[model samples]
Target: MRTLFIAIASVLLAGMTIMSCEEKDDFVPTLLLDVQDAIQVSNRGGEFSIDVLSNLSWEANTTANWITLEESTGEKGKRALSFSVTENENDERSSTITVHSQEGTQAELTVVQESGLTLNIFVKEGAEGSGKSWEDPTNLSNALKLAITGSSIFIAEGHHTPMNIVSGGNSDDPRDRTFEVASNMTLIGGFPAQASSGATPDPDAYPTILSGELSDGNNSYHVVTISAPQSDEEQVVLRGLTISDGQADGSKSSATIQGRDFRREYGGGLIIGGSRVVLENCAVKNNTSDKYVAGVYVFDEAEVTILHSKLNNNASKSNGGGLWANNSTVFAYHSEFNENSGGTAPAVHAYPNAEIYLFNSEIRDNKGRSFGAAFYARADSKGALVNCLVTGNESTSSNGGGGVMMYDNCEMEIISTTITENTIKGPGGGVYRRKGENILSIYNSIISGNTQKEGTMNIDVYESDADPAKILASTSGEVVFDANGQIEEDAAFKAISMLGDDFTPIGDDNPALTYGMTPNHLKEIDYLFPESEKDWLDQDFHGHDRSGSTTMGATLPE
Candidate 1:
């Protein structure tokens, strides 16, 4: 009986060992998540939780810096992960939290957070409530009436027109409609719907347009008129707004400016008169006029500041298609004037008493019916173009200057500016001098790739042949310098930013990257007039910090 018991015990032990080996061979680690759906967070952001289940030791990791986890590692069974997400001020984004077990079992949880939009007075199209909150929103016209000194009116995506506009002062057309803003306030556009908690707002995506198509062909004379006093001190700001489709219908009053009979028919898209205004990330475009100064008219000692803005596709009958300044001042930074047509200066025109300071801007693809496709500075007009790009401008009429023209006694300065690829039918390919003492003081700049089909190549002096050698080495790097280069072809440029031409120089093949000095304390046109716009001299077109030795032509080499 004892022998039988021992044998049975031994057989039982052997069977137990076999069963243990089989279990070890067939074992598999288990890691499971309680939730498979992704976690969602609002733009306000807050704390959140996720459930996890595992049979072995597990660890959690996330690469996103915006996410903060309560614990990184855990062991066994069902557990809850506590985490928080910060508020997103920019675009909406997403990230993944990876959960890994000791036995190579893994799970993932995605976290998506929306972008933020701030507003003091919300304006949405077809809203029935007040302008206090997103839910109780109002229209742009209503919000404009309610905006105060410190108020920031946020307009949502829609087409907004003027309700009540008058020509004022018994002018020619009293029925002309326009959106008139005359307060020290700010108008910011680009907002998702009030009920959309998951969407982000991009100005290009959700366009908030202020159109002037009042009734098809009978459009307003001016789409928007900014008459806000002290708007030049940045007291009034228009950001991410599109002003378009203005067509001048009625006649304008006549006035004498700079001792000349200057017609006051101006500003089909925007009008800044006797006040200061700021346009940031705004588009003033697609306007038409039978008179001069079609796109934007700056007059009456007004100051208009343009930052990262665009004036394009405007047509005029006489002088300026994109911008016209008369006894006023315009300071443009990182702005663009493109595709304007049918004027003396298709892009910009400064009257004898006006001044325009352009920095890190682009003048491209403009077509002039007469002279000066890019810009025209009349007698006694003075300004500066610093680190700007001028290219692809054309002139169909037989006059001068496809890029720029300087009349007698004008004083304009160009520093580290690039002028190239302009086609002219008359004298001067890049710049023209119509006799007299026109001082085009060019310093550390380039005049290359210009085509004069009927006359001089680059810089025409007294409507004669250009002295390229003298213009290249005239004082170079100094205040009274004249620096010019003829590279024939600009193959070293990177991607094209405008007019199918790349303005950014790249590689050692381009000399513009190393031919520049430090940018600071630029020379002004005058002491009392055309005051220097030194607000962003130390910054480049991309708003990158530029110090020491840097590249030229409104941008750095790639």
Candidate 2:
């Protein structure tokens, strides 16, 4: 009986081993992907693959419809599975693709793609079709409405008035007519429609104009309004266009003042609020306003940059015939302000807490009835003028500062600049500093050829004592003279005419030619206040390099 039991046990053990071998042969497989998390793709959309390390029948599925696999179901064994995605035209997008095996094992692959590029719109003169191309162009007003963010509007040469503008109130009132600019859009003018490739467009030759003319006898409105807030990453550019013949009467309502019965009229040419605007190689001229800021008004935290532009022949009833900055920051580089007339500040007016930076610019032939024919820095404001020219400005009334005026608590710095040929009827033909802790620093500059009927020729610091020695002693920095600098002498400028193309001063004998001192004080100020270098001191008015040897005035003697 024991021998028979041992035989049965041996047979049972052999059968059990054979059954285990058979079970191992029929084992189910699992899915294993090389990359289970993320895969980056290009913006134009392309094919990509993932390694599938498994011996099983697997099926693939995508969470987003933009992703598609080459084969939905496949028998994989260490093979690369191909997949493709469509082009991402909008923002950045992501998708997930899952591979499932028969054994219930799953792996996911996340795909990411970047956004596409922006669109470009075209506009040509006398073209009456769609604005998609140069051959079929549209009007300026239509293009403005059709433009979205990340769009470029290229305008050809023509006189472009505000056509079919949306009225602010009444359609018959010219003050209600408004032309608006969208955020993150660029308007580039002065281009010939049929220009050859690699050829630079000359703004003088093309001459695109934005005129504010109405046929119905209504001529009282701001020509352009930039009220859109732009992202910090991108700037809204208005370039190579002439803005002219704008008239802003008091018919339109604005922000109410405390003492005034009605809101003040402002910005006959352009009005900017809560926006980031850049004006490059443009012209603003022949504009008039009843109250303030006939040329351009920047208010309510707007940041404006004017580069290689011109503001001329603008008139205002109150202040800032060229530009008025109220609670805003303005940067003027290689620009010109001329023949602007205002009641207070003819060229520029910076209000309380406003910051004004003038670099390599020219302010000339401006007339102010009260104060600061060139510039006015109000209480608590800050101003810097570097390598600038302030000449031929007149302050007719008894206020002060034919070149520049600084009120109580205002701080100003002038470096490598020339303030000459200015006339004031009362005080400070070159510069005026009001009482109460005002700071004025001058270095490597020329303050000559200035005249005042009542007070000083170069600088006047107002106080009860009004002593020249006390005033010079109380100044913040060294008010030293430049090389060959003359005080109250004739600048000896030749052919300083107001003709169309003869505005520049001539003659090699002019003291302003090579009288500038090196801008060492700018480096010192930069070290003391690192943030002050935003007002550039490395270039002249005509975009010429200002190296060790610099010229005093705005331009090289030519």
Candidate 3:
């Protein structure tokens, strides 16, 4: 019996030893994930981390190109896996980082990066909340501050004045007083609280105004100034606003070159320098400047494009009451310049090395005290006017060229245009070229009813003899010339009236209706048009189809 009990005990001990060995073989550490299901990041790019609660080794990997894991592998026991993302320039994106343990357990952390923000502004109403929607619109001043690059600002209808305090002082500095637009930004006005079916806002229904009403003694400020440097990758756009009441009195100093003090009153309404600016459906009126360009000024290699806009009732003490461009490229299309007064070139003045293009527009009812009541091109400037109308413009000074004045070494081309009813106090009521060898080419155009008060010549090339055939040519239609490109017959307009925000010609017998030849240069320079603009050269200023009978002036008869 003793022997049997010992054998049973030994068997039991052996069994216990085997059970212990099996338990040791099956031993494994537990692994767990302690992190949020998802996380959010800004569009500007940032870093974040996730906590891993595990008793084993873990690894993490990202599934997106923009997202990257900083620490892909980590040890056990509450380890942090870091990750980062790049700046989101296109749109919102999402990615996931999967963290897996050696025990085959896995966890995911979803990351979402947002796109750029767009703000809204309503000056009439108060800003009370975030400016993401119409109901929570902010002020224009605040919206400009909150907006980042590539962001857009939609301004509702109201008169928005500049913030009087910029960088804490109201000094004579333009950067401190004017409304400065940032680079790569789009500012659109004339929007209602809610838009209709159409994507574009109607300027007539929602009249957005930007006024500069702060009277700082005699030193006035410009309404808007764009001095930001723009590249080919980015552009700045300003549209659908009435910019008025700007007053620049030539009191502020711009520079001291050669012991002379230059003024900073070039642009009363807007000044664009070293920027790429586009102005569409805008009205710049009722602005005054003591120097040049009461309406708009472009300088320092700026590229400006103005389309379907109006520049009226602006006054300048010097040149270019409507527009002044110095060493810049300016393209004005389907626009109007009326009732502007200045010392010279009431409608437009182009300085040396400036390139100006005016197409399918009107320059009328303007007064220049010196020369070029309609348009002027200084030395070494290049100007082209296509299918434009220059009429009812007067030059009050003793200089010539009420319709157009081209200085020495300037080049000007007028194609399919009309020049009528312009008066000059000296010579060349229709057109004038200065004494030097300048080029003034007129093709398929008309020069009629222009009077020189104190001179006999209607089109004068002062001391620069020009051949009538070489200087004037026509491809398809007759280039009308009545005694040195001046016709005594009436233009026979239905009415020369400003009728309710519309300039209309009501007569069917107008001479400009049937004498026009569309040139190939119109399509070659079509790149000047904005991306949103359609083929407008085939259309009139009133949006009438010109495929039937192309009109010489800006307007087409219905």
Model 3: per-residue lDDT, tens digit, 1-558? 223434544554455445546676664544444434666565667676655665568888887999988998988656777778898876677888888888788878788776654434333333555677666667676766666556777777777777633322345553345566644578888877464333356678989887776544332357877754556755678889898887766665553221122246778888777679889999999999877789988887889888889989999887789988888989988899899999889888888789888888889999888978888999798887766888889988878888889887887877656677789888878788775667777654555557786645556777746544223322111233321345324443222331112433334554455434453433443232243433555666556766755345455555
Question: Candidate 2 residues 1-558, lDDT tens each?
Answer: 223434544554455445546776665455556553675554567677766655567888987888888978877555668988887678778988888898898888788665555567787765666888776778887877666555788888887777654323455555555566744679988888674333345789999888776666555467777755444666689999888877777544753211111222788898887679999999999999877789988887778999999999999887779988888899888899999999899898998678888888889999988978898999788887877888899988887888889987787877666677788897888888886777777755556557876535477778755433222101111233344332323333232331113223345554444445444534544421236563465655565666675455444444
Best candidate per TM-score, number? 2
Rank ordering of all candidates by lDDT, starting from the highest: 2, 1, 3
Off by over 4 Å in 1: 1-120, 167-175, 195-201, 231-234, 254-264, 453-455, 463-501, 504-552
How high a TM-score does candidate 2 get? 0.68
- TM-score for each predicted model, relative to the true structure: 0.66, 0.68, 0.67
The C-alpha RMSD of each candidate to the native structure, in angstroms, is: 26.3, 18.7, 20.0
Better of 1 and 3 by lDDT: 1
> What's the C-alpha lDDT at position 526 in model 1?
32
Cα lDDT of model 1 overall? 0.70
| TM-score pick, better of 1 and 3 | 3
